[model samples]
Target: MTDGEGWFVVNACESRWRDDGTLGSYCTFEGKRRFPHFGININVLGPGEALGMYHRENAQEAFLVLAGECTLIVEGKRRPLATWDFFYCAPGTEHVIVATSEQNAIVLAVGARGRGVGGGVVYRVSKEAARHGASVERETTSSAEAYAEAHADLPRSRWVPYREGWLPSDR
Candidate 1:
């Protein structure tokens, strides 16, 4: 939906998840068509699911937990996160998010984008991430090399509507 003056608006329910079940699910906003300075996406993770390999990128990235709970593995440290928690990863901060709650978790992610913002990402091995099956055994600058063994298809998954006032339990 256009905002009439270049701004675009879209509900998460309108976007389908990509490559679901293999790890986590994500609905990437059409930033290329609307916003040019940044990228945005909504990530959904089920219990024990990882967001992908532990990696760091040249562009700064941030996340806001919209629902449920998850574990943030960053720089070899583990941080438990719940709904409404926000996380910021400066450029080159190795990290990955894994769902720890019984229910699915949703995260709103944003990242810097523009000229000179290299899209380079390097995968790293982290003991904390290894337990979640997100760690790479070796350092690699190529995503192809980092995920060469992955076989998940890139088809879009069915979209699920978010429930109103859904908050994670205080467990």
Candidate 2:
């Protein structure tokens, strides 16, 4: 647990969101810093905000709710999630998470990475998600096409105080 050449560290509180400000991520470690093997992001979703278009990917993904609440729409089913809840999606398991709580929700997400992993993400339609205008009607591997009508810039996450003593130790 070090923040050296190979290891990285940053407090979620200090992380800046994308320009859009709908969601924020501690993605520097995995995106710009180029941490390899697997990728990790601390995602913050604002109230009523959808994670993304309803979609499934070739790579396996897991999420841990660190604060607030959300609804997990997976395979057309709605699952409510609260703090400390964990969700895992196998490759091709269509899913999306939408913040339903009044306050913004924080989720720690990790995904497998490597050759032969993450074929791509395909957006799909879901009646449950459609109720919130978060689903797509056609299948498409093009994220650009799926999000063509969306805000051009990616939004950043909002800052919030972490639960006391919940931050992981660097050791």
Candidate 3:
């Protein structure tokens, strides 16, 4: 549906679920329209559960928990998030969400479908290193040490790897 389409409101009970068990309710313009800007949805996952690790090739997303609690592992750090809590994941960040409460967990996720134009969005498993896999290393190094680590052929400088869409253009 068009973003301007009077905010297509839907109750959790009214949405459809994928075979994998995610209740997916689309914005007013899902497949009902030819081409839409992006997709938005509110997901409800039962207790002792989670949404696994999978990367979005062309989208950036933010998950906001409305009820219950969950552990979010982003690049290897586990952070607990409760109601009204939020997390924004840049594409390829590698992350995951696990519902820790016995009661159902409710989350609102807003995302856009576009390449780096949208940004990085990845999920890591909250507790399982195997499920979440390896992580990036952050070492303590002095500026001179960091500079010396640069490739011999390259200029002597320390530059962070650029992930295409982590920040808004104007920012």
Task: Give the number of the best model, judged by TM-score.
Answer: 1
| Candidate 2, lDDT over the whole model | 0.69
lDDT of 2 at 89: 87
Clashing pairs in 1: none
Per-residue alpha-carbon lDDT of model 1 for 1-171, expressed as tens digits?
A: 332456556765554346455566677655325456787777777888877789998889999999889999998899999999999999989999998999888888898885253367889978888888888778888776676544345443444444332324321
For candidate 1, the per-residue lDDT at 165 reads 28
Model 1: what TM-score? 0.79
Question: Candidate 3: global Cα-lDDT?
Answer: 0.49
The runs of at least 3 residues in candidate 3 whose Cα sits more than 4 Å from the true structure, single-residue gaps closed, are 1-12, 22-35, 54-58, 116-171
lDDT of 1 at 116: 58
Candidate 3 per-residue lDDT over residues 19-122, each given as its tens digit: 22321112122324422556565555566455534233345678898788887766666788899998987655656676677666767777666555323333
Give the candidate order by descending lDDT: 1, 2, 3
In order of appearance, the predictions have TM-scores of 0.79, 0.76, 0.55
Name the regions of candidate 2 deviating beyond 4 angstroms. 1-5, 20-28, 31-33, 115-118, 152-171
